[model samples]
Target chain A: MTALLEVSGIEKSFGGIRALNGCSLTVERGMIHGLIGPNGSGKTTLFNVLTGYENPDAGEVRLDGVVITGIGPGKVFRLGIGRTFQLTRVFIRLSVLDNMLIAAQHQHKWLRSALRSPGQGGERAKAMELLDFVGIARLAELEAGALSYGQRKLLELAYLLMADPDVLLLDEPAGGVNPTLINQLADKIKELNSAGKTILVVEHNMEFVMGICGRITVMHQGRALLTDVPAAVRSDPRVLDAYLGGAEDEGLEAEAVRTEGGSK
Target chain B: MAILSAKAKPISKGKAAVVVAAIAVIAVFPLVFTNPAVTEIAIFALMFMATSEAWNGFAGWSGYFSLGHAVFFGVGAYTFAIIANDYKLPAGSGLFLLMPVAGVVAMVAAVLVGAVALRTKRHTFVVITIGVFFIFQLLGYNLSITAGASGLQVPTPYNWNAATFNNPFYYAAAILLGFTVGLYWIIRRSAFGLQLLAIRDDEERAKGLGVPVWRVKLSAFVISSFPVGMAGALFAFLIGQIYPNTVFNPLFDLSWALMTLVGGIGTIAGPLLGGVVLESVQQYLNLYLSNADIYLIVYGVVFLAVMFWMPRGVVPTVGDALRRRRGAGEATIAATNNGGTDSSSEGKATGSLAGVVQEGGK
Candidate 1:
């Protein structure tokens, strides 16, 4: 059978530097997949390409053997691949629950979908259930902008779940989060994985990535270095080199600049 | 689950009472004050309110910030005139009956025009709209079907010289205004409306969250164009004549945008309140002043004052002040959310998408 998601030879460039080059991976059904890399190593870029936020220069991405390349974010999302950003994006002006409502209606025919209230009965229950799943159910009534940083991440995850995407792409879910929240997030990921969802997470935090993901993919300089079980990935010398040997990778500032230029 | 969705903001009992009373006062306005001159101001007020509200629906909520909505207004007016001439419709209600056709024609034009214009990014989008506006304006001057600069004189209705001359126009404008406001109110509460508000906040994020951004923006633009086109038709009938300059005036676009901005864009009452007050002051200024240029200066001042003093617009500012007076917490959801929305939306008035970064993939 075809893998749940398959990517082969994806390439993307910005100005002079390659952000993603010949990136390839396969995510089996229901696997908690980890994508970890050093700074400027194409983890976010890969996610962006996979989700159609960035159209790859040369590549094929198939979901269940159906080629889904450069379909655009809206179509990609409607096709059941949900993604969350690193910095925790949510509609600050909208109430938290309405955030979920927006998610469920994105693919609906605008004429009919817009006129009918998506806030009624089943959808609202599902929204609350997702919010509860992410532990932000209590904050549903408040505006998303009013959420604390950690709470906003939870809300972001909650809204993504509102769409019930088959594959979840979470970028740095543990970044800037406190330890308590990190543990909570990891638990949620495991619970979600066991309940029949496939997840691909890009994280800087090794413990967070290793603790939950069933398999891990290590990327270096815009290419996947290896994909192995966490124990095998943990002891890989190349993974250590990708993290440490590159002097520029040590500073957060250079990674940030590359991220803004490459990811967007 | 019942978290305050946009649909959740019910009109309070007191607010509802005030709304009913206001509508009552307006319903009898032409009768209570029979003078055509007074009724004329109310008529123009209604027309502007309707137009500004139309502008607000797409430009205000979707963050598209079109400066060329006058294209729809003019298209509607010209559609009415062209259809009337083709069908040889008479001067009375027969001519008036064609207004909805005018609206449909404008809606079609908006779909075509907005489809092309909406493809560009925010700043480029503004420029394209302005460019289209000029093209239509030039077409008004050159097109033979439009009778060139000679202008088309509409047939005068039976009530042209009667005491009730402005009454039909007045009531029609009022109905148009009411219809526009009600439609927006429904739209603002609908799921579509929520998506629009999301687009306005951060378009990239909204798209990332799965919103079909371009389709939503285009839908709103077309929807907004219908009322604006109808309003133009009504205005065309009221004038009993049509010219490219008269129907497609840049000032109409400018004034409507200003009215919506000063009234508090993105809120239903804001456009209505701003449209009526600003248009009344404008008409009143025109009545007393010998020159029209002076009122333009007044508009300039009002624009600056609105920018500096009540940048968030009258309704929002007043609402906040009231909430503060009621001893609401400093960090209440409204205040916290508005703080982010206030800045982005104000920039949106000039068609800046400073907050949107995620759309390069296309």
Candidate 2:
């Protein structure tokens, strides 16, 4: 059977740099897959291409056996793919609930509804529920910009979930989040996966990725270096060499490789 | 689930009643004040309110500052003139019938212009709108049908007495202002309006969330153009003549944005309030001041004051203060209900997020 999400031979370039140089990866249905790479490794670029933020210079992306390459971000969203930015892009001027309502209002008729009462009737209740799930229900009425950075990240995740997307592509879900909240976010992701959603995460937190993701894809130099179970990925010398050679950072390599081997 | 008082209604029932009463007084205002000068001021103010509201609906809400809206006002005025002159249609209801034609012409022009402008970056969008406005202005100056800059005379539809003459145009302008405000009230509450706000806030994120950004902006542009065009048609009748330079004047274009800014940028009542205050001050200055240029300078100072003091515009700033007071009152009431333990503490818990960060850092 075709994979739930597939990126095959995608290429992207920004001036002299190749962001995604013939990169390919597949995500099976109902899997919490992690994408890891050193700086400039093109994992974010691949996420952009898949979610239609960036146009691919070549190659194709398929979601559930349908070709969706370069269709643009809006269409990608409508086709059951939701994404969060590396830096939170929540509408700062709007109230937190307004942010979620914009996401839930994907239907055609809700858009054209002239009366405010009917269009917003159930959305606030539903948005509050999502906020509760994300542990930020108390911040529901505040301006989104007024929230802390970690709260904004959580709001972004909650708003994306408001769209009820089947596949989630999260870029650094734990970036800038406090450790306690990072653990909460990880728990939320695991809970979501257990409930049958497909997730693709691009993260640098090795402990978080190794603890939660069943499979991890390591990328180097805009190409996938390896995709395997966390145990094999931890032991693989190629992954270590890529981390060391790519960044000249033995610390990150050691942390990624050694920290979770014994615990698993 | 903690049920919050249904998110504050855009306008409360009491405020709506007050607004209705004010509109009623304004509706019958001509009978009380029959002075021709007063009627003329009313006409100008209402016409300006309609036009400024049109500008605010699209540019203010969408954050796409349009510098060339005179393109619509001019195109609309000229559309009515061309049809009236070409068909030799008298200034009766036939002219009134052709007003919508004027609106349609302006709307079509807006669609064509918006198609190109909406695609470009914001600064480029501003530049292109200004360019298109000048192009239309140039066309008006050169075109023979536009009377070659000498201007075109449109006959009054009805030959009413001097007292009654201003009344029809007064009522027409007033109705148009009402219609424009009503349109804003609907659009502001609609999903389409929310989409426009989203586009304004962060357009790329809006697109990622599946808002048809270009389509929503274009729709706003179209919605804004129609009323502005109709207002132009009424202005042509109000003045009983139209000049290429006069109808298409850049001052009219600038005033629409300025009025919105002075009153409130994105609030529903802002443009009308702006028009009333600024235009009245303008009329007063024009009547009293010996030098016409001095009023412009004074108006500039007022605009600057508003920018510095009340940047969110008059309506929102005042509205926020009132809401905060009411919120404090509600908090006190809730505190009393909770046996004087002060539930307000939870709502007023400043720096809660800061505390979270400090605790989590450990």
Candidate 3:
């Protein structure tokens, strides 16, 4: 199998502190990959670098052996990498369907987008179908802000799928989701992987990540600690040491804020 | 017969009648109120309506509040004046003819302005817009083509009847307002509009979704310039002269934003209605009080009162209450932002959504 997404020696620093120091990762075609690290370990920053939200201070990211760095998030998305934020950044004031339509905005030429409703005839049905797949079809008419946090995560997943991306970078898919919904999300990820879409998911929910991902990469202090099957990674002493008393919500938010501040 | 049809989303009969009636009233206003003072007030209101609607079409929807849109207005006025001066048109022969050139020139100005200003967002974008506006204002003052602060005089229609002189200007303003309103309505429902809505709500998410936020924003800013520049040209024609200070006035910027904010910031009808009512109120207070200080103070007080009561602006605040009254329970940020688009239609969507849920249970 070939590596669909490969990053080598990515170096990023926010001020004096290094966020990504020579981080390297590779996801083979059609693989379900898990990226896990403790708070401030640079998992999210690496995601940012990979998705073109931040330019790496050094190193390379390649999709199908083509270098993609410093291209910006919009170009990154068009290059077939769709991502969901850790904080679930759906358009709060748009209707649920409208949010999905914004993702399905593939016919992105100026005049076409202006003349047709964002729900271009085919897109409406497709958006509704994806919403149904995500189990939020019933709430599709409501504003996305009115949705519960877990529902918004599901909506984020559903909408990103509208682009039919070759790769998806989900930042903590099971973070605050209820158990039943977590199972549903897990099943959906597996289904997506089975359907030929490669995925790299970041999660603090160890069981969900270990159960779904075929290969797991552990990060520590802006560097890759190790990469192996979930069982071997879980049993590794180095991996356990890197985790640093488990990933907590406050730490995640603090990292989110720090990286956000750094980006600005 | 209607119950059997599949149409559940279009505007209702009552709304249609109300819209038709409003249009009829607007169409007849100048004819019925031939008095110059009343028509003058109407003409100014229509100008504000046009400019505010165009402003809202960009800033209100995209969440980039530009306090320097008067640059486009000034550019349009100057374009019209310059063309008229060089082309040597007879007095009143083709005054409105130059207005389209004004619009095109304004659009070109928007392209240059938006290319730079749209790169930033939030407070920085606002500041950049102000900076761009001042640059244009300074040009209006210093440039030889603009004739400095002395300004340029353009001729009004020579044969306008004394009793009905304001009528022609009034119609010009009204037609421009109509055109702007139509564009706003179409854009509000377009996919491009939704993308703007997304950008306003979350720029990062919009980008991640491949919405082309930068280009979309620039386009909206340019589209907004056409009507605004035309309104500027019309204002120049009405006054029969244009000055740098008057055409590039920051007051124009403040008023367009204030009217949109007071009417309903992001909704289609917000700026249109807000401009008319707010201008009328300002005009009424000035007419009665006749003192600049007192009337200006009174206008401020009235504006504060409007905000205090309708915090989200007239259309959204009222639309939210009406939706709640009808049991849609759509009392969210969107109740104020999306205007009244998704209210009743949601019921029908919910009905079908429920059926799908039941089917899923199987």
Candidate 4:
């Protein structure tokens, strides 16, 4: 299948430090692609560039063969690239349902419908449906700030689904979430992919990534070292060396142990 | 049916009843009272409400702190003054015709200012607005037609008796205030308003959610300028003069910010309640104190007190308290109804929330 998102030769630097240098990756349609790396591997930086939070010094990003480089975050989002932050940025003061509603596309002419009721047009029901999809419908009335960390991550995930973007860029979806919720998150990611959505996930949780991602791109020191099936990536000597030197070997070992000890 | 359907959310019956009764009293207020001082205070209160609500639209709702909204106010007063000076027309209706003209002028200026200012970050936007405010104030001082620092006196076009004179301006102010408040309510329920609130809570996230942040904020700023500009025009006519120092004073901007904060910054009713309470206090202080500066000191103390005790402002703080009390009462009722099993469920919800609240703040 042709790639849904193509990032080629992305070069970004901050001061003297190179965050992304000649980084390249392609995410195929209808697949969960995991970008795995140790801390400071520039995985999040790549996500930021792809989502137009930061422009690359030299590179090109294409969504479905359409150039979207340097379009700015909002325009990139409109062009169907949804992203979540590593720190989980949500409207903390707003209710969870309103949070989802805000993410719903407003197609009306700007000035014409500005005076109309926001809660009209079945947006509420759609938002609630998304909230239920993420298992947070019961907490929809509470301020998003009231949600637990795992729940916030789930809400952020659900918020992306509100737009039903062509591609989702999730930054560390499994981080800080409990094991049970992490499994559920993985299941949801699988379900979304099976439903034909393209997902580009940046994650540190080895087992979670290895279990969910069909294709794995191993990044090291601001570059993609290799892209292959998860099984091949898990066994690759270069991937092992990168993780061993980069201090994420424990997570790598955990993935191996989980796969051997469990069904996957 | 239209009114009910238009509401973004259902209003409590108690609140609706209270609002109806309040509007009735205000409608007949001028008919019963003829005291100029009382009428003047009423007029000032209405004008302040309109201006504060206008300022609250963008600044309070979107967390964009604009310290230079008086730029529009000054632009409006000058628009009216300039038009009145240049045109020789029929008496009573001429001033009314200029109101919308002043509003349009202020709105166009807002579009220009918002275009440039909103490009900057929030803190820088405030500074840019201040810069624009000073530029206009300087223009007001130096422009030959503005009559310089001596100011311009607007001639009373119509031969109006005391009640007739006071009544029209009062009604005008009241109508403007009503329109502004209604517009605010409509915006609060609209999709654009939700976008603004999203930006307020988290701008980057809102952008990621596909809200055109700059454009939505600019629209708010332009809409806000209308009522503020119109209020400025009416005030110019009410006072029968326009001056750079008085009309475009930075204090007017401060008052707008202050009134909104006192009411509850982002709440719909906050600005109105804040305007009424603060304006009444100012009028009282003016009546009681010979020196005006002491009242300024009192304002500082009141601001500090509110900041310390009710950082969310009066309305939200009180509302939260009432909600908590009602929640506790409901828990009590639910406990009796369910033989105390509801207590643990309630505890589970709030207990987990305490940790999340602190975590979310980070």
Q: Which candidate gets the maximum DockQ versus the true structure? A: 4
- Where does model 2 exceed 4 Å of error? A109-121, A247-264, B1-10, B332-362
Over B1-362, each residue of candidate 4 has an lDDT whose tens digit, in order, gives: 12213324545555678678978877888888877778787888889988998999889878889988998898898888888878854457458768878999999999998888989888898899899899889989999989889998776755788655688888888889889988887787677877887888788888877777878989999999999889888988888888999888988888888888877787777788889888777876786676465657767887899888877677766655655666686865432322212211122112123434655465
Task: List candidate 4 stretches off by more than 4 Å.
Answer: A246-264, B1-8, B90-94, B326-361
The TM-score that candidate 3 achieves is 0.90
User: What does DockQ give for each predicted structure?
Assistant: 0.40, 0.38, 0.39, 0.44
Candidate 3 lDDT, A64-171, residue by residue in tens: 898989998877888889998888787767778778888878656767777886665567778778988988887777767667778888999998888888999999
Models, CA RMSD each: 4.8, 5.6, 6.5, 5.5
Q: Model 1 off-target regions past 4 Å?
A: A246-264, B1-9, B158-161, B326-362
Q: What is the TM-score of chain A alone in each candidate?
A: 0.92, 0.91, 0.91, 0.92
Which residue pairs in candidate 4 collide?
Answer: none
lDDT over C-alpha atoms for residue B142 of model 2: 90
Per-residue lDDT of B92-143 in model 1, one digit per residue for the tens?
8667677788999999999999989999888898899999998998998899
For DockQ, candidate 1 versus 3, the one ahead is 1
CA deviation > 4 Å runs, candidate 3: A245-264, B1-9, B291-295, B327-362
Worst 10 residues of 1 chain B by lDDT: B353-362
For A1-264, candidate 1 gives per-residue lDDT tens digits of 237999999999998999988999999999999998777888888988888888999998998888888888877888889998887777776778778888888656667877876576477778878888888877766656666767878888888887789999999888767778889999999998988999999987777788998899988888889999999998988877777777435533444444434332
lDDT of 2 at B94: 53
* DockQ computed for model 1 against the true two-chain complex using alpha carbons: 0.40
lDDT tens per residue, model 2, A190-219: 999988889999987888889999899998
